[model samples]
Target chain A: MKFTRRDFTAGLAVGITAPYVIGSARAQGATIKLGMCAPVTGPAAESGGYAVKGARIALEAVNKAGGILGKQAELIVEDDQTTNPGIVLAFSKLAAESDIVAFLGSIRSTQVHAMAPDVLKLGKPVMIGGTDPNLTHMGNQWLFRFRPNDSYSGRVIADYGFNTLGKKKWAVLHSTDAFGTAGGKALGAALEKLGSPAILDQGYANQSQDFTPVVLAIKQSGADILGSYFTYENDIGIFARQLRQLGVNIPWVGSPSITNITALKLAGPALYGTFGVADYAEESSEASKAFGKAYRDVVKVAPDNQSSWPYDAINVLAAAINKAGSTEPAKIREAILATRKFPGAEGEYNFDQNGDGLHGYNIVKNEKGTIVFDKHIEFTD
Target chain B: MNNPQFLLPNAVMDLVLQLLFTGIGIGAVYALVALGFVLIFRATNVVNFAQGEFSMVAAYLMVVFAVDLGWPYWLSFLLSLAGMALLGAIFNLGVYYPLRHRSFLPVIIATIGASILLANSVLAIYGPQPQVLEGWFETPGIQLGPVYLDSQYLLIIAVTIVMVAFNYWFFEHTMLGKKLQATSQDKEMASLLGISVSTMIMITFIYSAVLGGLAGILVAPVLFVSIQMGSTIALKAFAATIIGGFGDVAGAIIGGLALGIIETFGAAYISVPYKDGFAFLVLVLFLVFRPQGIFGERVAEKA
Candidate 1:
């Protein structure tokens, strides 16, 4: 058809607008999308919120310094609802998006376990804070950890309980789930290496309101020290309260749950003098201090391991994406594995081939319900 | 393959008894919650999934009235109970009444939705963190020979007994009780007789909600008040109700106590890891073998 002056004007406008819209969409395509699966509503919500906050802070910092591959990064968050089934569904929804270059896993080993098969299927790198050592060795190529596994923490706890405290007899308490059982076994093996096995080894379930019987058993076992791997903050709080009420005043060394603010706040003075190997402590390092201050400014609360690790994971992932020069999964994986001497809020991390990093733990003490950073313990294995 | 030694030494026995007492103290709290579940289910066909959250909201309200608003413990407790009763009535009017004629699934889902909204609203206002209830009547343990029982345990048991007796009298002796029974049995007949079935249901909801609120206030010192605390206890109370016999008041009490003892003894003697599973195991077994529950009457086939 012949074009009039008005038709020609409209055609020019359409041509110009179409190219801008197409260019904008293509430009947006350069930005990498990352999915974060965290427990935002259940018992672990406190920690999960922190993790999200940490990730956001890291992402903002990365974007300010010129985002990954010169494009802005976006985080797509899904609440895991603090269950294995919920986590699996969340991961599947994230994986279906196709644009996500990497994934940020939850702090709970069970959540990671539920999401791992999907991660392997998707072939995208996942930075996780779950401490279960077997998560990495489970032959999942895309699974990478940002914190020292429970095996390392177990060794640290065992050594500190046995050698540092000079307590030979031990009572080991853990949850019956996979993470607890694995951590308990690792701790038992570590203690055995020192020629001092746990006198009374016990496993309990989560969300228990009373832990008196378990504490009494430990008290009766004649163990002068207590080693535990509690999977939930509430259970740990109850256990700590009952342990004190039963007059079992032995030195207690535990996993990261002992340092969680929820446990500390719930247990109150009951958790005083308790020790744990934590991934993050506000006083751990300069990076942690700065992060803690920033977090406190935003959330009006101190940062915990759950918050710090995800924060660091995002930073490390962003750094890798920038270095990779593309949002492609394989390239991002390469950049992540190449992470070396990266200072993060959690600690200096180096992602190994198996996707584990931060091969160290911070020895912390709960002083009158506040986590006091004591010292750092590094492991080579 | 021999039986493992279960008894502890004398010193350990003393410690174990103390721990058992502690469990019982908390068990009393569970019993109170389970009792609310039983009362409502017995009076109405509704399986109020919001019972635990009702308790939580009441407990938090007590904190607000007592601690923040600076009311005395007793006054705060009474005011919170009244507030809970009002909430119960409102919930019935707003939620259950609209969906009363619907299938059980919709009502159940509606309760779940209400629970989510209630919990999140609390979280949004109070923030998602645990808050300690101040001015608790945490009396020191009373020593009776070798066993030391906390005064809180005694208070819980005494309060539960009084509440149970009051509920029994209200359902058995009063005119309102007869109307409630009539409404529970056949709503059409009750309404035909001008007993006001809708009004009776509202009263039942209020009574149950008040009981749940009382339970929450009493147990707050033991379990602490957190937005997410309701779901766990609610599940346990559901299991307790099922095992005791759904819609049976006495069965609920028996079931709650039995669960408490079983869980306590199992944790002490058997496996602590499987302690919480004890209730579920019993619930499943009962569901398979005795679907009508321990105290429930067998129903005839519908015409």
Candidate 2:
């Protein structure tokens, strides 16, 4: 307990190593590193890559606009491997880097949930595409959502499917993952609000290759309409095919994954008439149209929610950085919380204290393998 | 529930039958993959976890050769199978042979490593997006009474039968078959009797890889070709292999078909959400009660 020169030298050695341990964190450099955690190589790679592309486009655009705080903004990307542990590791690696001021989180709610604690501990802002409502409301100040949470999308999907389409007797199908379960629960609640309960509520695992039984169950349940929140595009594609094969011609409304180009292409004619709520559509708004056209010029495909949110996320983040005039976390966080009337590929954006921006969902229909935007629904609270 | 009257003029019945047909088609693909798993496991006692990746690689190769290079489907198909066989041989020589005498766990793990490497390599080369294979074989579904079946499904069933028959004949009557069987039964004894155990292992891998390639090529028309396709089918086939008795050839074939039927029926009658779970649940039950599998031979522990 006594102070001595030996102890003082040892304490100084610990202090020096502590700063070294936090690699890239507070590095004496001008470059502002924005960490991007995405699924670059797994089942969700198609969508995740698009998100990364959008983020990169935003990064390039921001750097062109004189960079953030007059310092070059660099995106430090890490593949999340599409698993919880992988995401945690990627986040930790990024968090350890002192120069990384903010991060772009994954589309998987589970991954975001796993990465949230680390993001909070690191005290860095993370813009996320995951729509799980609890992600922002879980007392995590650093977590920012670029897309409207499922709680908003679910009500929109139910309202559109029942009131707009004037169909009742719903069949709700969802993947049994965190996103799907929560989306399904939200949709079911929305349906109940309209005095119509789901005749058949089902949950399938991600990456399922067959959806015959699910389709058959829907057919037998006497449901005239269907709603789903599939976790994987492939599963949604297969399910769409099986549903058509089973002659279930009812109006189908689903969550964002259903509107993915991959699903549309794989399912082909089977998904032609399906409707869903998405964060990004090729034809959402004038701003969205420009973003979509630009994305098509680069990626040679129409933009979906996966591609659009990250585009908006980057633009919003860049705007925040520019407005704050600093790469410091508190300044950027304040600017992000003050986001208002900023046009994005998704829609006009505003960020709450919880970091969720753009409180609207784009209703889209699969019009012969193309996502045709129908309408947009904005929400409060 | 068994009343025939319940079946007539009911859209629900039609839906069930349609699902059954669809499940059968998908299940046929699973059976084909499972057959490959059995072939390699039986001859080499090495569970090729990368069997699915073999199929994926072959399918992608076919896409590259046939679709991209504008070769005929038949030509590309044959070349893809040959390419997979060659890959199998290379894998056996490079990875399996060196680790042949090692524990089964190491061999399994190695296959997993190989699977990851192959999938990632394909991703790196082809990029992550799914590609549709172009060919004349991709015709629209043919109506069959109340239900419809894609021509690709029929082609898959026919090809699977032909391959299964060919494998049966080769294993039962061929000299190479006898040598392989001899090696599988007793590798050291077969080596003493002048049969090359390594060669037999290589041949077995080639055979299985070809089967996997054929599955990929055939199923690609329905599912389209993607790197992740192999892993999904591989898991189902693994379950199928366990159900049929790990090393039982007939069990693998029958077990695959039975699995397809069970999954289809279970999905229709039980629950659609947990359709894949049915196979895994059955696998766990089988492991608990009949670890050797439905048709697997019982082996004594060496220790």
Candidate 3:
């Protein structure tokens, strides 16, 4: 027990290495930790609820299939409050825990953008549902998308409206938030490429109580086709109601939100006959069908992208961690990127170099309160 | 607001007509909520930041009664207003009464605290999903000539007009209103003159809550019942109060109408993204040029 020069050096070494060795022991004592930033309160709380349920369902399945690294997987969730600042705070709260190796990020692109810097600083792989193309493309290797980005949605919407619907003059309306702004620009660019430039390119702030001016503008523009990127279902509900009320019933094709269960319920009859580029469709594939059944059995409701992405995210993250046989961030990232032709609820998971898992959308219609799948549009380019 | 900008000469008139109707509809909504702010500000020198939350709470109450409990629309409306009236009383007792003798800063801070408490309480109870409350009318809207009038908007406008008329008659002619006015003018003097100042203040809170709740129920079908909905309406209504001259009943209505029209026309001609900016810009301009507000100078600075 006597202290000597060699003993002092040995004690210093033990002090330095103890936390790592003890931390590993502690990590091994419990299940594999996965942090999740979810919207437990605020505007997106309902969708956030669905997302949590999806992750939990996937967690159940993963545990049933023998979880990651021969240990049961654990999911730790923090309320993001569905705000940019909220997600940052939530992610930080999760990041504070040194044991959590990976994270499931927000479905909102803006929320993802807000948390991107922190994700990079954390240097842990985060499975995201944010579809902003720049999310993965922004040189942030830690972030991997579970859903198809807006680029595919924009192209699908434009292609369907032009080639299938046979509409030319278009009025594009979008929310002014990061997601909507990016989606609107993508849609605009896509339409331009299809030789059908938008007659009226309008961007309204989200949660708008009134859409009279927007409806009036669309009416006067004489646009036969409408392409929209609404952020919130409330806005969609209001806009659709006002659009119909104002008698501007142009053939409307919108982003994924248009055909979501939340939007469909809120907008009701007003949203009937509109088209949306959905990332998850029940009939799109067998994986999608299976996800639909699993979700419906657990959630007692039809599955949408909100629930589907998180479900796929948890499955993918767990699968990658298992494939790598480790919780090391770089190994998990490598495993995730190498994943190809993996059947997912969204679609086939073929991760490109940029960490995008899916690169296509299924066209869905609100046919008398039912989201009927139209066709799938996949892009290799 | 009905300015001719990008429309053809023929279409300009129609657009103006439509904008005017829509503006008035939206203006009436602001006016209704602004009246609550005015009533509370008139009675208590401190502005109740919870004034907006009053509408939100009422809307949620409506959802609970009407949608959740499946009560009749009229019964649910009455029950929701009743709930708001009770909340007003509780808010006064819990938040305002204790701080009654304190400085205006303490009281204002208390109201802000109360606002957060109210919003969080609702969030705890109802959750965050925005609920839909169908309008009083089965028919959604009516197309009157060139203008498509939303039924809810029309109902709001009519209610606002009736409220203005009723307020004029009640405040000018009724003995109770005169006594309440006296209490607002000078609580000490009114108390000396045999008016129960505390009772008058309580009535004012009740009326203000009822007014705000009414606005919420009316606009719920149009805006959809959400936590943030009231704050959005209340912001413009607050601007309306300032523009119309703070604490003046008439000024709040006129200011609300003006703000609504300016916003609509501004979004149309000027820029859509800056729609809210136009309202605050007008507020800033008023703060600069006419700081006393449109009606602030009148009534010899009473009370």
Best DockQ among the predictions, by candidate number? 1
TM-score of each: 0.90, 0.90, 0.94
* Candidate 2 docking classification: acceptable
* DockQ (Cα-based) for each candidate: 0.45, 0.33, 0.37
Candidate 3 chain A lDDT trough over 10 residues, lowest sum: A22-31
In model 3, the runs with Cα more than 4 Å from the true position are: A1-28, B1-6, B298-303
lDDT of 1 by residue, B1-303 (tens): 001244447655665577567666666667778878876665566678888899889989987998789888988888999999999999888778899889767877888889888888887787666766742555535666556665666677778788779878988999998888888777888889998877888888898888888888887766778786777777887887777777777777777777777787777777787888887888889889987777877521210
Candidate 1: regions farther than 4 A off: A1-27, B1-23, B67-70, B101-109, B138-148, B186-194, B288-290, B299-303
Greater-TM-score candidate between 2 and 3: 3
User: Candidate 3, DockQ to 2 decimals?
Assistant: 0.37
- In model 2, pairs of residues that clash are A23-A97, A24-A97, A24-A98, A24-A99, A25-A97, A25-A98, A26-A98
- Report the lDDT of model 1 for residue B112: 83
Candidate 3: which docking quality band? acceptable
Error of 3 at A359 (Å): 0.9
CA shift of A344, model 3, Å: 0.7
Scanning candidate 1 chain A in windows of ten residues, the lowest lDDT window is A238-247
Clash totals for all candidate models: 3, 7, 0
Clashing residue pairs for model 3: none
